[model samples]
Target: MSEFDKKDVPEERIGLIDLMRTIKVVPLVTLHSPEEAVPLARALASGGVPIAEVTFRSAAALDGMRAIHDQVPEVTLVAGTVHTVDQARQAVEAGCKGVVSPAFSDAVVDWCMGSRIPVLPGTATPSDIEKAYDLGLRFTKFFPAEAYGGVKTLKALSGPFAEMSFLPTGGVGFGNAREYIDLPNVFAVGGSFPVPSKAQRQGDWKAVADACAQARQLVQG
Candidate 1:
């Protein structure tokens, strides 16, 4: 049995979904080294955005999460690019408050469902959305948003899945972030654009902070 029973979990609490919506922008990050995690988190918070989805695309994910969780408790953290229950469990143990997958994985979703852990599975098509709906999930991540038609596609999805909400990632940037946030169906936007590769690699935390501040302004405005 899981640590938290599904039936015992209350619905009134301000959960991950609520936090994501409130933040309006979630930085999708992949840390190259654990040493960068605390500074990177500080940059995000200083820039006005205090949430990050640390991806498992790199081996530094767990350590990076630990660094931020231990040093920057103010920044909300979630695990991204998770592929299995083990990864999800590790992420939770490492201090991530939620889990996000690039693709819907049955095992991972099931584990989250049973454990009452919040998860935003990726849904790129009608079928994928239906699967998520059937699993009782109302919020999901629309991935590779640009390639799948971006705003146009999300507009269409709203017609049928009216109650469904999304955090559209991939190809999202400062150039068109306002367009996505304007949509009622979109709860928030996720991408690495706010943390530019050049800035992160060069340890130019101010640049990252500036980018985050700009993104927050786009969402609020």
Candidate 2:
């Protein structure tokens, strides 16, 4: 069980909270061209999921974020896989309102918190959650959630760190997303499901949109 906080206080910033609550399904998108970013974001938004985590796994991350920010303004874009302060700075300048990482990094978390970007710092253990809570962050991402025990772990964690809200990513997909979404402590769950690799590689924007629509319906229902 993770020993962190007692409860979460909802944030006023929609983009920030979307990183937690509404974006229960996040598209971990990595496009080859920045041009693909806007269209993809538009598709997701039109399908009812108005957000995405544009990861730094690809060279086009910043450019994609810029394009999405400019052309698909309704999509709440977040910069992900931030490993350094400079990257975080660049992401914020590119119009990302939030940041996420695959693992916990105090420096990265501090940088985002210091800046205007609200952060969903990853926390997979009790200690990680403690550090995040100490930094005044109530929301966090539980990377490799399934491998680390998933719902059972979260339920156990709630007994101690009930205040901390989570957005469990890694291994999250259509089959089990609702199990996480229904949890009071889980504000959201993120995965590559919204834009499956095969679909994106095939340039199936419609499939992406349809997937997002189905995901939205599942979470809502």
Candidate 3:
């Protein structure tokens, strides 16, 4: 049973989940310069994967998000590694369609729920999953997936969390991405694998695009 009396889960969030399921892969992007935003987003789109999870690990996250929002409107943007309500608010203002936290922060979750913003709180254990479930959240992120048993853990979770879906991130890469995506409980896989670090740092947009295309094929193939 849910702990909350009324789950104010927004209707639009369902559409977002459906979109993610179709995409099958989400690029976990961290920007060092806002200038890289437009080109990187365009590369992802050109490669047939038009979604990016711009993490707030860098100082330039907000500016980069704003640039992508304004210049590459076709790409779906979600804020990642968010730690505070302030960051979440800024992310939405910068044009992120949703908020993704690395851990389940009650304040952040409550705020996003009240504001009608879609939030995917990270979960690593049954307790964490229960917290999200009690709040009426059906979708959550399984972080550090490789470190936490990878496909095995997801399989174990499926029995107890039959109605829940997951976005498995952390340590997910091209080699085992399809394995994760094949799980019935997984909606999509998230990682920095699609945007290779060397390619991104060297401003090799074509390499980045090629990496994305390969990743897309790996899952959809």
Say which candidate scores most in lDDT: 3
TM-score of each: 0.94, 0.91, 0.96
- Residue 132, model 1, lDDT: 90
Give lDDT: candidate 1, residue 217. Answer: 88
lDDT: the better of candidates 1 and 2: 1
lDDT per model vs. reference: 0.90, 0.81, 0.92
Write down the TM-score for model 3.
0.96
Writing each residue's lDDT as its tens digit, candidate 3 over 123-170 gives 999999999998899999998799889999999999998878899999
lDDT of 1 at 74: 96
| Residue range 1-221, candidate 1, lDDT tens digits | 12332234335213676777787999999999999999999999999889999999999999999999999999999999999999999999999988999999999988888877888999999999999988777788999899999999999999999867899999999888899999999989999988999999999999999999988988888
Runs of candidate 1 with Cα error greater than 4 angstroms are: 1-14
Output the better candidate (1/3) by TM-score: 3
Kindly give the stretch of ten consecutive residues in candidate 3 with the minimal lDDT sum. Answer: 1-10
Looking at model 3, the pairs that clash are none
Spell out the clash pairs found in candidate 2: 5-163, 6-163, 7-163
